[model samples]
Target: MRLLGFGLTGLVVLLALISLVLGPAAIGPAESLYALFTDTGTPLTLVMREIRLPRMVLALGIGASLGLSGAAMQGYLRNPLADPGLIGVSASAALGAVLAIQTGIAAHFAFGLPLCALAGAVVGVSLVMLLAGPRGSSLTLILAGIAISSLAAAFTSLVLNLSPNPFAANEIVFWMMGSLSDRSMSHVWLALPLMVVGWALLGSLGRSLDALTLGEDAAEAMGIGLRRVRWQVVLGTAAAVGAATAVAGAIGFVGLVVPHILRPLVGARPGALLWASALGGAAMLLASDVAVRVVLPSGDLKLGVVTALVGAPLFLHLIYRTRREMA
Candidate 1:
């Protein structure tokens, strides 16, 4: 497990380096690395420090947030399909951002949009917890999450529908599609703190999650607090995923896919999967961002679109495997 964790960390670092070098303007790997560290006010330095670095940071941060949250949720819920998106946190956060955009508050206040999204995430997760209860069954949690997702999506559509500004509507639509292009360090600054907090909250649950694998009663008998675990998972996921969606606009499946891919490497230990999934998710998103640049240098391809293209098939395979297992 330690070896696997180290391997993933190295992979993520490699992908981050690759992300720094690959972009519209051609920069050699060595030069890019140089500019990243020593800024000499050159165009390459400006691009490296101002643009690519932030995008790389966000890609890693958002991916880690989603991945860690996914692992924590899956462990807490003991369900393979449990994810931030499954509980409507992403959708709700998107709606908050959309509202900010439509109201023009985001334009005036730099942090307005992200703050609103963070609030929406908190509400969404809280509602999910309320509906599903602290100790709800897997089916109950899924149903509650679906209900929350549907409601949030509808509200988001309604906001778009009522907007009189066509450009604003189009912008909202495009943003919802998700991307990592032309992002500034401000975004990285805005989302990183919340994501870090979320990571800490979730990471603290390693032992609890491991105990959970033995069943709730067994975990309880072993002195684990189920209620505390639920709160931590819910709030932590909201903070991390909400901040991510605020900056990146609903990049899905990093959470859903990363843990599943790396779980085997961690010997299927939920607690041990957290850091591995975080590193794997960062690597995956960085690679996807690189693919977007190469595949569509014209910037036509969205990050979310690329992830969905990859994740949807993996999702189907997971479902098939699950069915076979049940059979």
Candidate 2:
């Protein structure tokens, strides 16, 4: 486990460096590093500081959030098939972004899209909690999340359909597909605080999740408060995922794929898996972002599209394996 953690951490760092250096600009790696630190008011400095740095930071932070949340969710539910989106925060955030685009608010204001998306995520998570009620079971929580997700998705489609501006509708569609392009330092400031809060909440759950793997009765006998744990998982996931979606749109499969890949390496211990998956996710997303630049430098290829292209095949294999085991 220690070795695996170190490897993943190193990989994340290495990929982060590559992300900083690799871009449409033909700057050399050493020059890129120097420019990043020196900030001599050169165009390269601006590219490094204003563009590459924030994108790398957001990728690292959002990827870590998704990976940690996925591990936490799977741990709490004791279901390998579970994903971060099962709670519906991502869907709601998308709806918010879609609304901002369709209504012309995003076009007029720089921060309008992310702000509205954050509002939508808050409403979505609040509704999920309310519908689940204070004493609701895990099953009840899942059902409530499903209901909210479906409703938000329906409304999003409605907005797209009713949108009068073809350009707005096109923008909405592209944003939903997810990208980190054109994001600024302000976006980093806007989303980082909430993501940190989420990291704290979810990171603290390692021990409780370890206990949960033994089943609820055993966990309760061990003095673990299942309800508290449940609340933490929901709120932590919402904060992290909500912030991520607010800025980056709905990048899928990081949460779903990272934990599953890292689980066995951590001896199937959810506690150990959480941080490991966080590192793995950061690395995965960094690599994907790099791929976006390398594969389609001139054309627009979304980060989410790259992730889905990689993750969807693995997901199908997981399903096939799960069904075989059940049968």
- Maximum-TM-score candidate: 2
Q: How far off is residue 53 in model 1, in Å? A: 0.6
- lDDT for model 2, please: 0.91
Residue 197 in candidate 2, Cα distance off native in Å: 0.5
* Lowest-sum lDDT 10-residue window in model 2: 313-322
Stretches off by above 4 angstroms in model 2 are 319-327
Computed on alpha carbons, the lDDT of every model, listed in order, comes to 0.87, 0.91
Ten contiguous residues with the weakest lDDT in model 1:
134-143
For model 2, state the Cα shift of residue 195 in Å. 0.5
- Model 1, 1-327: lDDT tens digits are 777867888888999988889977766799888988997778888889899999999999988998999999899889777777887799989988899999998889968877888788878878888999987765677788899999999999999999999998998888888888988999898899989999999999999999999998999999998778877887898888989998889898889988898787888999998888888888888988989899879857889888888888988887788799999
Candidate 2 lDDT, 1-327, residue by residue in tens: 778978998899999999999887777999999999997788999999999999999999999998999999999989877888889899999999999888888989989999999999999999999999877777888899999999999999998888888998899899998898888999999999999999999999999999988998899899999889989999999999999999999999999988988887888999999999889888888989899999989999999999999988988887787799899
Compared to the true structure, candidate 1 yields what TM-score?
A: 0.93
Task: Judging by lDDT against the true structure, name the best candidate.
Answer: 2
Model 1 pairs in collision: none
